[model samples]
Target: MPCAMAIWRVYLLPLLLLVLLRAFTSLPTQAAARGGADPSSGTDDGKHGSFSRNLLQDKPEITEEMTRGYMSNSELEIAVQDFGRRCANVSRVYSIGKSVNGSPLWVVEISDKPGKREAEPAFKFIGNVHGDEPVGREVLMQLAYWLCDNYLKDPLATLIVENTHLHILPTMNPDGFALRRRGNANNIDLNRDFPDQFFPINDDINYRQPETRAIMSWIKQEHFTASAALHGGALVANYPWDGSRDKRKQYYGCPDDKAFRYMASVYSQSHYNMSLSKEFRGGITNGALWYPIYGGMQDWNYIHGGCFELTLEISDVKWPKASELLVIWKQNKMSMLNLVASLVKTGVHGRIFAADTGRPIPGSLMVKGIDSKISASRTFGDYHRILAPGESYEVVASMEGFTPKRTRIMLERESMNLDFILDPDGAAGQTKRLPRDDCGCSCDDDGKPFLIREAYLWLYLLVVFFLLVLYLLFRRRISSRLARNPPKRPVAV
Candidate 1:
């Protein structure tokens, strides 16, 4: 009996040991199957021990069907290409530059008229400077498709494409997009990389990667008149003159300052519920490094490039669901159209000042000569008239207690630093003032007073005429001088 019991213990003990070893070996695999142990994960530290239990109890399954509704980077590219192919007349896909990962940086040029590219002012719509904020790209693609499909049927669409060139670069950071990250492949924030007046190169938190360089190069080459960069994680429309800590910063009211305010006001009226006057609040004040940013794209666009650029923070939450796309599309579509449309027609922009004091005059009317469109100066005494380019027109200013002053001008070139002053009507109680023609010279038989004609044209002709006459006179003088004083000839070569 003792020998039989010893035989049973040896066999059973070996089997028990083998079973225990197998169970111990499978523990790590089971832990990994439950999402593994990530020390840096936002979950609690002690939770690692119960990972397997929690995962089995609370894990949510992500089915393939759910993912089919949303777009990946590759899928988006294919869709863009297909859309371009369908609307061959109005849309064309071109490469802006190559991404760090060797993918072509795509730009879709959308216009209704095929042959009028150069004759139009271009409005650039860019998206996804931060790879994680991909909604902008989707919105841009939708805009392109809507414009192309509705060009013939929609009057506004036809007018916009015919008059303005729409350049859309859907994804600026393709590499970061592929990785589903905010920073690019090199871990650089493209927004903070722009070469601003503050920083020309990457320093501290500012890092310019290849993607930003490509964008800067494209902007320089294209010379876009107006543009907007789309961002996510905030629900507001941000405009330029952003470099100062406060809205009252000195640079905010500089020479081109009126232009910045006009841009901000236009964008606010079009899209978001916020006002340009109150956009700077909380910690995220205007464009200043008050938030510790070294360089930013919007500031660079305004200061360095002379193009009016704004940052449109389109969503209140990050990674917005697919359903929110259409809502955003509807909200921004008209505002975007209006911004581009305003650049067309004719524009009158000048400074108004007090006739007596030579100080800025606020709330004055600036009427376009050709279209007779009126724009009013803001409290800061700056005004801009949006009209058809390459058209000649006059601007008139009228204020209370001052004589009306008018200036004939041309909108062929971008005008700058135009200042005006109104004069008082005669002395204290003269009642009747001298006519404007008296000071300017005489009026024609048609009663039209001409202050100045195309003096440059006449001056150019006069210079050429004078030079030709002088050439002839100089030739005769030289011949006469030679007859009077002949030069001595050399004896030999």
Candidate 2:
């Protein structure tokens, strides 16, 4: 028996090990054979295509059977147009630009004052950033219809529609959706096509995809306060900094980390069972902490556009069954509404004006400790600064050729209105002074002239005058005591 065992170990054992190794190696081959084989993936620019991790491992190949009930590119456009006509009172449909394959990127602007500038916050909801993640597109359409259907019926919807300009882009990658691929017709990831802060790969504006260029131009044209892009394959509200300077996987937060966290919490807590997530605490995460990726849309929106953006991964399954889309929409409806309402419901909002002309001035806003700045709208001079409530902040409003004004406040749960009326810097005999609170502040108060630059000298003279008055009062008190009692004074002498 020992001799037989020794022979088995020497010969048969080696063969068994070889068989196990072959089985282990064949697993990847089987996976690739199942979904990763795409023949028409080469870019229009004659470059080889590379698939994202979601395309290969996270999501299976999108078959026709899986996308039966989903809307085609043309169908989505028609639905957008139909929504515009149906909700003509509060919605307008316009095309931002076209896709690589010449598909118009339709946008539905829903507001009480659509296409007109108002002293209100503007929010954008971009869906279908990735062509395969069709859930966002469907859910966004549902959001639009729900808002239209419940405009005055539901208080939340009414607040969102009446107070905020809600822009909905259902599909950013129509060509990719048509191809049933992750990237656009050029086989490039739209999310990664934005200019990155850490890496300069996307710095060349000429090389950007058409869809990316459209979004960029839209941001430049409109002053959005905050925005969110919907995605799938995970369930978390992702905030920036998406990539670290060292390119390491760690928690790298943007300058407005607290504000971003609060914004993320608002979405996660509003979602059904999102805050109960076990994978992500509070169902929110910093983007880089999860895994660093450069050139993400979330960070770019914050950095370049001054728009607080959240990359919301709303579904665990990338390409869920079409039947499940409604359920997903129901799950995230409140989150979407609350996120938009947050623009008006919370934070600091106001407009800047020139004191001399009493006209709106397009100024910039900044917080004392936060290393970021946002600009007011050119048309209305309105600015909205989203901050974490229950904290104190020193808000500053500044413009060129005008004196900067600042005020400190303890931001409560409700939103605060703090407008500034900056005086011309060349104005003479005006002492630099800040207003006491968030109420409107101006250089001139009730036709009273402000003090000149010799403020400290005036303070010194006032102190001396006060001292003289105190001395006189003390002498008067002494004389009154003497007059009353004749001082038993000399009695001691």
Most TM-score-accurate candidate: 2
**Superposition error at 325 for model 2 (Å):** 0.9
Candidate 2: regions farther than 4 A off: 1-59, 427-493
Report lDDT (CA) for all predictions. Answer: 0.59, 0.81
Question: What would the TM-scores of all predictions be?
Answer: 0.55, 0.76
lDDT of 1 by residue, 137-179 (tens): 8888888888887897887788777867788888888787776
Question: What is the C-alpha local distance difference test score of candidate 2?
Answer: 0.81
By lDDT, the best candidate is 2
Which lDDT tens digits does candidate 2 get at residues 1-493? 4664676589756855665554453333332232341121111121111212332245468888989999998899889999999999999999999999899999999998899878899999999999988888889999999999999999999999999999999999999899888789998888877777665543357788899889988987888999999998889998998778787789999889999999999999999988999989999999888877766777778887889999999998888889898899989988999999999989999999889778786688999998888887766688999999999999999976688999999999999999999988884222222221211223244433222223334555556655765686588678778788884545554
The alpha-carbon deviation from the true structure for residue 248 of candidate 1, after best TM-score superposition, in angstroms, is 12
In candidate 1, stretches whose alpha carbon ends up further than 4 angstroms from where it belongs are 1-68, 113-117, 201-208, 245-254, 272-285, 289-292, 345-493
